[model samples]
Target: MAQTHTVTIPHFVTEASVELTHLTAAYAMYGTPHIQPDGRSNILLVEHALTGDHQVDQWWGPEIVGPEGVFRTDQYCVLSINTLGGCMGTTGPGSIAPDGQAYGSRFPALTIRDLVHFEAAVLDELGIREVAAVIGGSMGGAKALEWTLLYPQRVRAALVLAVSARASAWQIGIQKAQMTAITRDPHYLNGDYYHTEHTPQQGLAAARKIAHLTYRGELEMDERFGTDAQTGENPLGPTLADSGRFAVESYLDHQASKLVERFDAGSYMILTEALNRHDIGRGRGGLNKALASSTVPTFICGVDTDILYPYHQQEHLARNLGNLIGMAKITSPCGHDAFLTETRQLVQIMHRFITRIST
Candidate 1:
């Protein structure tokens, strides 16, 4: 298990200058810290996706970061910080407010840049002035990209997978629908449902179902379930209430329920809102100009079947970034979630990228 640590920032001002007092950052580190001759730790920062926490090994584990993993603990110091507005041990809607209640509905808005700023502060507290590499996928990828731009001198390299420089209209539209589902739930209680007996579990489940569809490939979905009905349920029953469900519906339901049991609905809303606002070029001029200005070594990867963030986004980044080695296409049937599902392929790509930079 990774050891958890917290750093208290007396005053954390957001990019918009929103004052956030008494901010706390929760993070975990793997492997022993190895200080380089240049006074910086030989560290590799791993940013997690939407529902991920500092527990990188739990989801990524031996497949990505253990002794047998691509980023072996024995080789380099590995660390992961729970992003700002995260539910798991990080400051978010579930965290306590100055008024002695959960922030809940009152939690301030956040952006991808704000998350990178928070991570920078955490790194400062740990005396980590620079990192060997920064890596992430999806929402995590947005942060990794931001880090390369925000602190170019501090980051030696960055690996971003399954994300874009900015969230597209299609992405925002889907997120808006998910947000609407959460707010429309009767139990949402205007986002201040912490003290209530019921949370917006049903609403969150609906949102997850919608997201799950986008996370998976259409061909894979059809191959797995096709037109088959769930064994115990009948789709064409006499009564509508007694109608059976399709195999696909059952799979989505399981995914939804699993999230509801482990995640906070309010945090989900905040993070999704943050994701919708992800724009690496914001306030830094235009996308091409912004990427072209950065000299940090960057490795871009995209899922060939990803519908949410298509491979073209990575292609664009590779074309523009001043210090890029081109984009690596991860071929998998898992769609947008291929970064997490296709571990072996991801490892190979990352290994090659790291080797090229090191040599």
Candidate 2:
């Protein structure tokens, strides 16, 4: 088990100018921290995706974080913070407000940069001036890239796998569809369903289903399901009005149900909005200006079969990053989540990346 830690933010004003106070950040540390006399060590910040928490080993698997893993806790002090506006131990919509009620829908709009700022705050409390590297995938990948631009001096290397420089219209449309699924649910109650009999289960589930569709890919679905009906359910024999579910539909339902059981719907919306608003160049000018200005050595990796955040998106990043090490490819049929699934392959690529940059 990893050691857990918490840091308090006395006060903060977001980029959007929303004021907050007494916020708490929940995080976990792996391996023995080697804080030097100057109060800094070899810190490797391992970030999590939208629905992930601070427990890196559990969700990411041994191929990523463990005694013999590529991260090598023996080599660097690994830190993983539960996302700020997340349903995990970190403070978010369900956290208590000054009035002692849940923040609920009143949770301030948080940006990807804000997430990096909060991570910086936590490092400040720990007296760490810099980190050896920042690594993550999906939303986590976005945070890793943000760290380089937002706090370049503090990060030595950034590894952003399976992410875009900014939110694309296609990505936003998919997110919007999920947002609609939850907000339009009769039980949503404008995101104030806590302690109420009415819960937005259906809506949240619908949102997850929509998201799962994007998380996977066309080839994956076709190969795995391919018009086959789920066991014991006959879509062909059933009446048209209440047809049985297809194998793919059943798969999506499973994914939705799992998320609903563990994650808060309010948090889902907030984080989705954050992803929708992600842009490295938001205030720095534009994509070209932002990527060109940052001198951080950013390494990008992409899954060839990922349709949600296609290989083209990463190709664009490689061509544009100001100080790119190079681009690595993880060939898998697992779609966008392949970055998480193909840990061994990722470890090999990263191993090479570190070696090349070292020489």
Candidate 3:
């Protein structure tokens, strides 16, 4: 297991012009950074998804971040930092403001660029001159792309998996609905529920259920659950509310309950909204123009069964990236989550791609 660390940024500003007096960034590092006199090493910056913490090993699993993982400490320094609006030991809605109270609903809106800015701050503090590669899947993928576009000089290559250059309308709609589920919860109390004994866990759980449906593939769900009720439970018990849950329902319930335990509803809303605002082209001209500006080498991967991001999005990226290292696909029925679960496929791609980039 990797240990996490924290750094307090003296001052920070958001793209929307919101200035934060202080920002605490949580991070984890593995292996020696650089041995050369210049004090720079081949660094692998692994970003996490929406609800992920700095402890990438916890969510990314061992195959990727373990001691003997792909980006092993023995060969390179692996760095991970929690996003700005993250709640896992980072400054977020739950963080206390200079006024000595939790920001809660008062936390300012954030953008994907803001996340990159937070990351840059952490790197600057650590004196990391440059990174050999930046890689991630899903929301993490978005950050990887931004690093190439915003600071290509600082990154040699990047591998973005399971994400588009911009959040699609369909994705934004889903996030909006999930945000509504949280805000409408009676216990939410309009984002001021922090001090209250009752929280919007029910709302968060509902939101998670909605989100999980998109994270999984349709065929995967069908194959796993079908019309079957959870083992020993009756789907037709006469009364719907009193009836036993379907296998699919049980799966979603498990996903939702698990998220509610680890995530804050307020942070969930903020991060989802941030993803909704993710557009690499915004103010940098059109999508193609912005993409053309990223001169760094890049490789992209997609999952064929990913209904949320879809395979075509990856193709779009391949077509536009300035220096495409080639694209690979993960053949799986697990959908978007395949990026996380399909370790063997991922290892094959990284082994091929990172080997070239690092060399």
Candidate 4:
């Protein structure tokens, strides 16, 4: 059985009231904190990607968070937070407002900095003034980058894998299209139709389908699905839906429906816009200044086959940051999703990186 702990921290987000609202953060402590009785806790904050929850062990396997895993709870206190704009047990746009209504379209626009600020509040509530390390992947990586900028002294080290310092213009363009697909649906009702009779299923599914293609690489799609038909129905059939179905289409449909069941459309829109507006250098300075500002030791990882966040982006992080301790390049055929699929390699990288910072 996994030991669980929940704590409520003060959170006054841009979307809500000015008064400090209670926020919930769930965590599982693995090992004891490496500190004196009165000293600061040796915490390792693990940030999750989009659609990911604090159930990192469930998604990746027990070895990644167990007594022997890189995060060995028996040796270190590990904390993973569900981000501010996420749906997984955390306070998000899908949550009920103080007036018992869902924030829905009324949820404020959240930046990556907003997420970092809330996370810092979590630490404050936990009596942790500083962390031994902060680690994340994908959008989680973006959060890690923001953390280094917002709380440089609080973090002694950073581990960012398979992600970019900022969302590219190309990435934002795709995100806009996804948002358009959802809003065009008559059921969306400008994001406040959650309690209504109809929900934006078609638009949400279409957006997911579009996103599924980018999450994978062309080579992976070609090798796995190719141009083969899924339903085996003749193209000359009467109805278009039954006329022809490609294997890739079937795969995408499965992925789309899965997200529709687990994720809220309103939360998706809010998070998507946040991602589109993501630029770590927005008010701070350019990438160089942002990286230079962080004094924490850094570990960067890149996936060779990733198309969404290419390997060069990792190189850019390592080059711009002055205190880079190591760079791990994962060679996988799984593309951008390799960080999830290639668990062993990720564990090894994390183990080495964490060990270096602990001592």
Task: Give candidate 3 regions above 4 Å deviation.
Answer: 35-39
Instruction: Give the winner by lDDT.
Output: 1
Candidate with more favorable, higher lDDT: 2 or 3: 3
lDDT digits (tens) for residues 1-359 of candidate 2: 57678889787777799888998999898876776776446778989998888999987777667778777777767899998889788888888889888887788888898888988988887778888788888999999999999888888888889999999999999998999999999888888777578779889999999888787767767999999999988777647877887888898899999999999888999889999999988888999788888788889999999877889989988888899997899988778988877777888987876665445
lDDT against the true structure, each candidate: 0.88, 0.86, 0.88, 0.80
What's the true lDDT of residue 104 in model 4?
Answer: 79
Off by over 4 Å in 4: 1-5, 15-22, 26-28, 31-38, 235-242
Per-candidate TM vs. native?
Answer: 0.97, 0.96, 0.97, 0.92
Per-structure clash totals for the candidates: 1, 0, 0, 4
Q: Evaluate residue 136 in candidate 1 and report its C-alpha lDDT on the 0 to 100 scale.
A: 94
- Per-residue lDDT tens digits of candidate 4, residues 1-359? 34556677655755233343666666655557666565456678888877777766776667777777778787777778777777776777767777888777877878777778888887787777888888888888888888888888888889998888788888888888999999999999998886888889889999988877777777878999887778764545578875877778888889999999998887788777877766777776788788877788999998999878899988988898868889999888888888887888988888889888878
Over 221-330, each residue of candidate 3 has an lDDT whose tens digit, in order, gives 89988998899888789888879988888889999988899998888988899899999999999898888878999999999999889999999989988799879999
How should the candidates be ordered by lDDT, best one leading? 1, 3, 2, 4
lDDT of 4: 0.80
Candidate 2 Cα misplacement greater than 4 A, ranges: 37-40, 356-359
| Model 4 pairs whose backbones collide | 30-73, 30-74, 31-73, 31-74
Candidate 3 overall Cα lDDT vs. reference? 0.88
| Candidate 2: Cα lDDT at 243 | 80
